[model samples]
Target: MVQNLSTLQLLLIVGGGIAYTVGIPVLVKRRPDPWPKTFGYHEIWHVITVVAATMHFTAVSDVLA
Candidate 1:
């Protein structure tokens, strides 16, 4: 219904925002070579958490309503 659609929209917005925030900085500017590579590990962890949170949020939201 409307609520499910809203949840999905919210998820997409939030996820895309996060990806943009993390991706732009790494790609646009360059300071050190190993720095971006090293930092990418942290970014990957963030991505995994975001995905997990999205899945968990959707499941819980569906169950609640």
Candidate 2:
């Protein structure tokens, strides 16, 4: 386990990180306005990030001895 997280956990953490890096920036291009007060797409991205992190942390299992 790296940093006490198992292999699968690490993969998920890394995958999520990659997805966040590639996904969030493209949000602006996907939408015509990309305004929080208007369409709220940016705000939705932020919420997705928070939820992903929460799921990763909560789902991490203990390392086998």
Candidate 3:
């Protein structure tokens, strides 16, 4: 159980980092225009970040528990 949680935590952190660093930048460069009242790539990036953080927190809590 501990080993599984550790692996999951590591994967989430690395995956989130990659998404933030590479995926978000690519999307921003590809679509440099805001769609519908200033909601743009940056906003999308933030949403993804929040989701990733939430998932990470959940995994960590589970591991600790």
Best lDDT goes to which candidate? 3
What candidate 3 gets wrong by more than 4 Å, as runs, is 1-23, 26-36
Estimate TM-scores for all models.
Answer: 0.42, 0.45, 0.55
lDDT of 2 by residue, 1-65 (tens): 47777667777777667757655765766543457576666666666677667646644532332
lDDT of 1 by residue, 1-65 (tens): 44655666566556655755665554455322345556654455455557656655665565578
What are the lDDT figures for the candidates, one per model?
A: 0.57, 0.62, 0.66
Residues 43-64, candidate 3: write the lDDT tens digits: 7666767776776777677667
Clashing pairs in 3: none
- Using lDDT as the measure, name the better of candidate 1 and candidate 2: 2
The TM-score, computed over Cα atoms with residue i paired to residue i, of candidate 2 is 0.45
Q: All predictions: root-mean-square deviation over Cα?
A: 5.9, 4.5, 3.8
RMSD of 1: 5.9
Candidate 3 achieves a global lDDT of 0.66
RMSD of 2: 4.5
